[model samples]
Target chain A: MTGRLRALAIVLGLAALLIATVLADAARRRAARDAEASHRLLVRVIRLPDLALSSSSRWLRHPSQAEPGAALADLPAGLDVDPAGALIGPPRAVLEAGRSR
Target chain B: MRRQLALLDYAVGALGRRAGKSAALGAGLAFVVALFGAALLLTDAIRAEHERLVEEMPDLTVQRLVAGRPALIAESFADELRGLPAVRAVEPRVWGYYFFAALEANVTIVGTERADPALDAALAHGRLPREGAEVAIGEDLADHLGLRVGDAMGIPLDGDIVFSPVVGTFGGGSAIRSADLVVARPAHARRLLDVEEGWATDLAVDLTTEDEARVITRRITERLPGARVLERRLLRRTYELTFDARGGLLAFLLVPALAAFLLLAWERLSGLGDAERREIGILKAIGWATADVLAARVYESLVLSLTGAAVGIALAYAYVFWLGAPGLWGALLGWSNLRPALDLAPALDPLQALSLLGAVVVPFVAVGVVPAWRAATLDPDRAMRGAE
Candidate 1:
């Protein structure tokens, strides 16, 4: 009976340890993946203004003098640009002037 | 009455003999209780240390925001902030997060004036990082990364890579906050992060009293329209939330310690045979009240619980301080050379001790009370005959 009890205790202890280990690994993996995604998002967002500034030349020479549809299309995935928004007003003005030409 | 007292004395003495089953039970109970106490003490000590570290941070912080995003305040803002009546010291700092390849971890890089007294006080080793590429890392980070003074670390910064020489290390009480912090010159952090003439972070004004934080914060908010000003206490509370988020993992790690304790308690209780039950019944049958039997059992449980708690606390201290439980440090703390921070001073106060005692005793009593009461209320004749 004592031997059996000892064996049972050992098994229970091992099971508990295994469960804890698996949970910790899962949490670590989840955190790592989330961190990677957040890092990628930040990098993508910060690069947007630079992309907009560089793409202005192509639209400026067009005779229509309207914001080029391709300029808006070049925006990164999941980013929406509203021409009427105040935050992007200055940049939109440049685009509008190019479209008017 | 005299015979009963003698029987009690005999029962106590029987616990001392190596051949006696009572002795084995007593020893096992004592061992388990000791471990329990140690665990409580160690956990409390770690908690107390964390609290102390949070208290030591600046009372108010004024940081600059760029386009609603956080950016380093310019050094010029320090001059503007210093002139304010409510402001104490405008400690302009440059700090950013960077990854270190050798450690395979991200570290916070802090840049401050080396001559500044407040910043200098935090240094634990050789000297503050003087040159552009020189760095001073946190004590916990250095230990984990196996870094020493003069070791060149490759710092991955935004738009640039820099090899910074580690000149020193310093300890902070918090495990989460203190880990992997590198201190450097303001120019270094600015150049690395590719921010021209801008500080990355600002710790505004150390106030005379904590009460002045809100007023000062409001003043700063009014002054710098886009800047974020936070009271130090509020910032600490935010850090505390982060700490608590990780606490679930720490609590999970303690399951083994708790399970061992419950099993020991169960084993001790299960060992009280029918013979002992009949003896207890006989006492009740003669003249002993239910309250008296209950009181004695409670006293016994109290003895075991208190002993266990005390021992556990001591063992935990030894594990953290003297002997150092290397296994626990690695598994739980994620760092091996973690010494108990100076801020951590866990006292054996009556309230804390009592709480530990209550935690152990109340649960055990809840489990044992009904069985003990049933044993005490059994008919003495039937108990003696070993009948159900």
Candidate 2:
């Protein structure tokens, strides 16, 4: 009777330990995946550089000018500019460069 | 001594016959535990999905306000933003809210330039809105309106005027909040909103450093007052809080169920009375030690717990995964059909299973210990006299 009881105890203890291990492992994996997904998202958000307006005189809003002062500098690479802003930069730059020539 | 061995042999045979039935009961209980554990896992998965979507959203979204009313941020502002030293990509997004009185539905029209990649990835059907008049509805909106790709639904603009041609549909992650989005080109949105030179919204300034997010936000606030700049982490937390109230209610519901399980296990183990007590005494009198008596009872209790817990956890997983946490949002908030945004993996791996086993087995073992110890230490002479 004692030997039978001892055998039962060993079996039950091992089974209980197995169940606990499975639950904990599942939880740990879920947490790790969540952390990885969050990190990926943060990386995407932080990759872009800050954009600044050009400081060229041609595009400056001069108070004395007849029209609202426009920045005549070239639009930065890979940027899309509205049609109105596109016309001023090339001509203004040419005029300024010619003065130096 | 031989007579005592025969009784022990008979008891062992009886246990063998009963073992099958006990195993079946344990299996049923294990299924329930597995279901419960699965539901818990599914909840975690849905939250993770929400976090992923929130993280993908722009770091700082800038919208223009005029006289406390929203105005377009000039198209040139995108260029202006692009030129800033701290700015990375200044993507202009055009959007406006539309109210459909007949359907009592409110929808937002979002427009993006063909050059923008973010808008492109969100598309679910048809090509991007190429012309100034075409639009793409969100999947939920499409379903509700019974509109499909190449289907035309008139969009009402200001002054009771309406625009025609719903060209496509798109799908997004958040079912709770993003159900009514309609996508179009920036020009189309601008026309609908009557804004000629600017955007309804602009996602500006991707900073290089984490610390710089605060600095850049301050600069933008100083430069363009009244604009809101939200960091990605803050936005993710905001979305998480949307489910916080629901989670509290779920916790409350689980507490009673857990208590009931513990009580049921305790009663089942404790119900053995004098006949069983005598049987235990008879075995102990023949030289069985306290450890042996305790071991058998503990073993029996552990088996019952493992079965019950496994079944419960499995049932919970099915409820969460297949049926989608039914009666959850409705019970918490009067909203039915709140589809969780993320896919949850609800499997009881080795560790979780072990934890659950411990939760059940430990208490029952402790309860059985005292009774087993008393039976084991009983003197054979006294026990026999008392039995007679």
Candidate 3:
């Protein structure tokens, strides 16, 4: 009976912690939402379309705002693998196979 | 229901009997969970912030392409774009990267007309950039150079050095946008960035209607053969792809470690020790059914896995949101030496959390129980003898 009670307590404790984490995250979301207006104003004042990642190249730092054609060309020389291509490879393969058939 | 509780009780006590081994397994599992959980949390928060903030981004940005490289477009380009039917306003922007040789880092310098009223809210100290060569800088930049208001620093521009005064520092909600940034007037920016007076970096064009983006983009491309137009939707897609690719890469790197841990777990659980085998034999001899014995093993696995996952997730949340994810931040964000204080908005996706827990727990419970099942179904006498 003691062991069973202890087991019940452990399970309840874990569940409570999970609930607390969720509630905390909710509170943080609310806080971020409240500050949205100020961030918007900053964006207008700064006049930049992307985050300040502070990389060597503008294309690397501001991928979203970079010239679309130049962005692909300006990737760091050693990093030959295309991240987007790598991610979509399997799905693209399946689609190509279907099309070929 | 009552029988299940009795089985759970036995499982808990049994785990306690082998406290060292159980604790080691729990600790290892928790670390793996925490690593993956932190990466997910940070990625989600950054993506959410990007999406939220991008609502204010300009409709279209026009840049001149010189041999496939982005070059300065004429200030007159804004005037030409303003004449378009769908164009509402066009602002010529001046901004460029400045390489600081001493620190071996690049600083982004932007040219603004004057201090916008919106800036007063983000200013940590002093006044905005006004008068000759006065500049407002980001907090991280200020900290790196150890510059305060009323201080002057000489910036090396071309063969000559241009000395500028630190008029103000930006902080608070603006840190993410302004870190490693320097804002100066167009004249000062042109002199420092070496951009010609009549030329601007690019044109930020705002459209009358969001639906007109496609039409304007087509017109702009037609008008300027060498022009590269960046639409807001394309920018949003770029951000999504960047974050997803980075997150996916990190998760991929962790796959081998996860697989090794799973293998280790299988080895430890499946190769049941002599004492464990004998204990299972005694339970079966005492009229405990194979189902009862199997139930106890499943309960033990559940208890360990759930507890480890909960603790790991809690640690990850605190690591990311509270402590700012110390060691992991620099590696993930690709920052070296000086880094902005990453104040990410906290985010927790319940579905993501459940999937992570399920990924760990299901394999663990299966690996742990299958061997216990074999032991439970064995003849009681044979099992005891085999163990001896």
Runs with alpha carbons beyond 4 Å of true place in candidate 1: A1-101, B1-43, B53-56, B65-68, B116-125, B138-166, B169-179, B236-272, B281-299, B334-349, B365-369
Q: What TM-score goes with each of the models?
A: 0.62, 0.63, 0.88
Residue A43 in candidate 3, Cα distance off native in Å: 1.5
lDDT string for model 3 (A1-101, tens) is 68556766876597567758756776876587665565565567766656665443445555555554544554321132244432232333432332211
Error of 3 at B167 (Å): 1.8
Sliding window of 10 residues with minimal summed lDDT for model 1 chain B: B334-343
Candidate that beats the other on DockQ, 2 or 3, i.e. the better one: 3
List candidate 3 stretches off by more than 4 Å: A1-3, A7-15, A18-26, A29-38, A67-101, B333-337
Tens-place lDDT digits, model 2, residues B231-323: 654545543553343334444456566567556645654554566667677767878666666666655555455545645564565566556
Q: What is the C-alpha RMSD of each candidate to the true structure, in Å?
A: 16.1, 16.2, 8.2
Comparing candidate 1 with candidate 3, which one achieves the higher TM-score?
3
Prediction 2 TM-score vs. true: 0.63
* Chain A alone, TM-score per model: 0.36, 0.36, 0.47
Q: DockQ for each of the predicted structures, in order? A: 0.02, 0.03, 0.16
**Cα lDDT tens digits for candidate 3, B74-106:** 998788889999899998989888776544566
Cα lDDT tens digits for candidate 1, B14-60? 22222354334335544554454445444544443344334444566
Q: Each candidate: fraction of true contacts kept?
A: 0.00, 0.04, 0.29
lDDT of each: 0.50, 0.50, 0.76
Task: For model 3, give the TM-score of chain B.
Answer: 0.93
Model 3 pairs in collision = none
